[model samples]
Target: MSDLPPPPRLPVTFRPGHTRAILLTAGVVIFLVISGIAMLLEHLGPGSRLSFILTGALIFWALAQLARVKVVADESGVTVVNIAGKRRLAWAEIVRVNLRPGDPWVFLDLSDGTSLPALGIQPGIAKQRAIADARALRALAEAHSASSALPHEPRS
Candidate 1:
């Protein structure tokens, strides 16, 4: 067997709680189902049924998108998953992680002068918990960036 050690695993992952989103999504689905059933029983037209179903599906999709946003960090880099897209950046690419007072979410300052929002670390009723999590994320980013800046050894 080869003597090489296993690669280091990512220890930090940030994702918003799905409780509220799930409830909201479920409520939408239930409302749509009930409405559809009522319309069917009342012999409503196809247009009404289609409209109700489609609207509920759209709302549920949007809520699911909110629940899916996430930010994952490891020794190598960070990955951000947003409502519309996903991005991965190496440690050196990140300049800072900022979560200022009054801000709705955490923002990442990139080396190219672009800022990326981390929607997963949002400000809400659990203000203290969110702040604490942001601090921990910043520490992780700083540590990884510092280590990545060091000179690498040359292979013989």
Candidate 2:
């Protein structure tokens, strides 16, 4: 018999759908910057050149952060990757998923008493879809948590 491992079940992913918009905006910004630099190159002093370069780098970094935030969940747990850092938590570790009204994103209430932001489910972009996705994620987390629970035992 073949020894190949079973294929992985696809993880549910949540991310902003503004990829095209973000890319287009970044591209336009870069293009404008290049044009401006070219036009001002002859007149730019050393200090002005350094300032322009630093500002350009900062803008690109911000754009990259905008495109990188995401969340992935599977049977085991959920992983949240934001601009600054990433956090992974097992289903048992997640106490609850809270996406309150007027909130920008879903927040995972953890067993450790700390909340983690799920930036991938930003509600400002598409409110309906965001709400649905958050609901589905919460259900998934609850299902896993329930399944991992111990069978009923006598209380102490």
Best by TM-score: 1
Please, what are the lDDT tens digits per residue for candidate 1 over residues 104-136? 889999999999998878767567767777877
Residue pairs with colliding backbones in model 2 are none
Residue 155 miss distance in model 2 (angstroms): 22
Q: Relative to the true structure, how large is the alpha-carbon lDDT of every model?
A: 0.76, 0.78
Candidates in order, TM-scores: namely 0.79, 0.76
> Candidate 2's residue-wise lDDT over 72-120, tens digit each?
9987789998879998888899988888999989999999999999898
Which lDDT value does model 1 have at 117?
A: 95
TM-score result, candidate 1: 0.79
How far in Å is the alpha carbon of 42 misplaced in model 2? Answer: 2.5
Sliding window of 10 residues with minimal summed lDDT for model 1? 1-10
True-structure lDDT of candidate 2: 0.78
Q: Which stretches of model 2 miss by more than 4 angstroms?
A: 1-9, 27-35, 38-41, 45-51, 150-156
